[model samples]
Target: MRSTLMDIAREAGVSTATVDRVLNNREGVRERTRQAVLETARKLGYVTPPDEEGGNANAPVRLDFVLPAGTNTFIANLLDQLVTQAGAQDGMDVHVHSIEGFNPDSLARQLDALTGTTQGVGVLALDHPTVREAMRKLAASGVPIVTLVSDILHVPRLGYVGIDNRAAGRLAGYLLGRLLGKGAKRKIALFAGSLSYRGHEEREMGFRHVIAEEFQDLEVVELREIRDDRQRAFEETAALLKRHPDLSGIYNIGAGNAGIGQALQEAGFAQSVIFVGHELTERTKRFLLDGTMDAVIDQNPRVEAREALAMLKNTVLGRRFDYHPPRLQVIFRENIPEF
Candidate 1:
C-alpha cells in the first residue's frame, strides 16, 4: 500500500499539521522541517489525495493551457467546453492563455514563463522546432503535457486527444470526388489555413493525395496560407471563381466556411458546385442545412475537451489509463446533433 500523510508525518518526526503546512507550501513552516516532510513523502511515494467536495483543499493542482487566439467559433467552443469540464473537477484548476497568432517565439515565451508555476500544460501549439524545445523544457521540469487538436511531432507528450486530420481530409476528398462524378474533368479550389498548423497541413496533404490517386480527372488549385479570415476567404473565393469560371468543386481545409459559402451564393453557383469543409459550427451547420455546404468533416470538440481533461487527471494523479485508439468522429448534415 502507498503511504499516507500520517505515515509521512510519522517518518519525518513531525505532526500531521506541520506536514500539511509543508506539503501545501504554507508559510511559517521552517525550511528544515519542510525538507524533512518532502523527503519522507518522496521516499515513501506518497500521492496527494483528490480534493474534497464542498471545501477548498490545502493544495490545488494548477494546469496551464496554451492555445491560439481567434474569433474562430470552433476553437472558442472547444475552450468553453474545456473550461466547464475543468471547473467541475475537484482540485484541478485550468488557466488558459492564448497567443495572438501561431507565432512560435511568442508561444515559446509563454511556455518558458509557466515552467515553475504550472504543474501541467495542455497545448495547441504550432509544429515548430522552438515550440518543441519549449515542450522539452517543460517535460524536464516534471510537468506533464497533453496536446489538443494540433500535434507536436516526436515530442514526449503525455498523449494527443484530437481527430486524425489526414483521415478527415481524405473523407472530404472522397465526398467531393464522388459528388463531382468520377473521371469528370473539373477544377477544384482548396482554401487552407496557415500551413504552420500540423492539422491543416496534414489535411491538405491527404486531400491532394486523394485527388491525385483516386480522382485523376480532378485538378486541385491550392490557395496558400489563407488564414481563417472570413473577408479574405470571400475575396479569395471570388478571385478563384473569376479566374476559373469552369471550377466545379471547392474544398476548405480550415475554417471560414461562411465566407466561402457566401461567395458561392453570390456567384449563383451554390447548387452547381460541390463544397466540402471541416467542422460543424453554427454557421457551417446552417450552410449544411440550407444545402449550400455538401458535407462537413466534424471533429467533436466537446469529446476532445472531455478526453483531454481525463488524460490530464490521469497523468497528474499517476492513474493508469488503457491504450485506446485516437477518437475521431465524422459528422455530416444528416447526423449533426442538435445543440
Candidate 2:
C-alpha cells in the first residue's frame, strides 16, 4: 500500500496540518521538525504528488538566516558554510540577512521585514528585551524562529542549535582551576562579546560559579565586555594587563581571542598566564599551536549551520525530529582541526 499523509505524520510525530504544510511547501514549521518529516517520508516511500495545474513540481524551501555582522571570522565562516550547504541541497532555497552589528533596534527592524518574506528564521541574536520582543512578534506572525549559537530566554523559539554554553564555561573553569592549583591567589579575567549575548553571559556565570564554589582560592576579576570588536578587545586586554600585572589566567567568552593574545604578547606576558577561550578559529588554532592559547572550547560551526538548515527544513515542512543532545568540543593544542 502507498504511504498516506496520515501515515507520514504518524511516523514523523507531527500533526496532519504540519504534514500538509511540508507537502504543500508552506511555512511556519520548525527547521528541525521539517527535516524529520521529510526524512520519515522518504523512508516510508512517500512522494509529493505533482501539481494538478502543471505548476512547478519543485517548490523552493525558503529559509532566512539572521546573524550579527562584524569582522568575526568564525561567524562569517559559519554563515558561508551554511549558504554553501543550503545551496547544495535540492529543492531548497535559502536567503541570508545579516544585521549590521549587535544593535537591538536594527535587529528588530530586520526581523520585522523578514516576517512575511521568510518561511522560517535562524537567529544568532543577543538576549535583550527588545530582541525578545521582536522574536515574540515574529512568532506571532506565524514565523518559527530558531536560536543559533546564542539563546534568547523565555521566547517561543523553535529550538536552539549550539553547545550548552554554561557547561562549556564550567569546563573552562574546571580546567583553569586544575591548572592553577589551590592557594594560588591567581587572578582570572573574563572577556565577553557583549552582555547582550545570553551565551556569553551564561558562560561568565558558569565560569564564576565553578571558580567560586570549587576553586575558592582563585580570585575572579571583573568581566569585560568588548563590544565584539577586535580593536576594543586589544585595548581592553592591554588595560587589564596594565592594571593587573599579577593576573594568572584569562577566559575569553567572545571572538576576540586573537586580539587578547596580541595584547598579551605585546605586554610580554604571553607565556606567563594560562589562556582559554571559545571557538577554534584559524587565529585561535595558530595561537594554540604556538602555545599562546592554552585551550579552546569549540562549538562546531559547520555542525551548527547544518543543524540550523535541517531544522529550518523540518519546521517549514511540518515534520518531527529525533531528539539529539548538542555536543561541545574541547580543542587543545593536540586536537585543533587544521584549516
Winning candidate number (TM-score)? 2
In candidate 1, stretches whose alpha carbon ends up further than 4 angstroms from where it belongs are: 1-58, 323-326
lDDT against the true structure, per candidate, is 0.79, 0.82
lDDT of 1 at 144: 70
User: How far does residue 40 in candidate 2 sit from its true spot (Å)?
Assistant: 21
Per-prediction TM-score: 0.82, 0.83
Candidate 2 matches the true fold with a TM-score of 0.83
Q: Any runs in candidate 2 off by more than 4 Å, and if so which?
A: 1-57, 323-325
Candidate maximizing lDDT: 2
Per candidate, the number of residue pairs that clash is: 0, 12
Report the C-alpha lDDT of model 1 over 1-339, residue by residue, as the tens digit.
435556777899998668656654458888988778877866776543344222434356788888778756788888898899888877788899978656889998999999778877889888889999999877665667888887877885776778888887888888899989966578998898788889888898888889888899998865645577788888898888889888899999988788889999999888888899888789988888888898888777778887877776665554445434345555666888887
Candidate 2: tens digits of C-alpha lDDT, residues 155-213: 86777888888899899999888877778477889898997888888888899899888
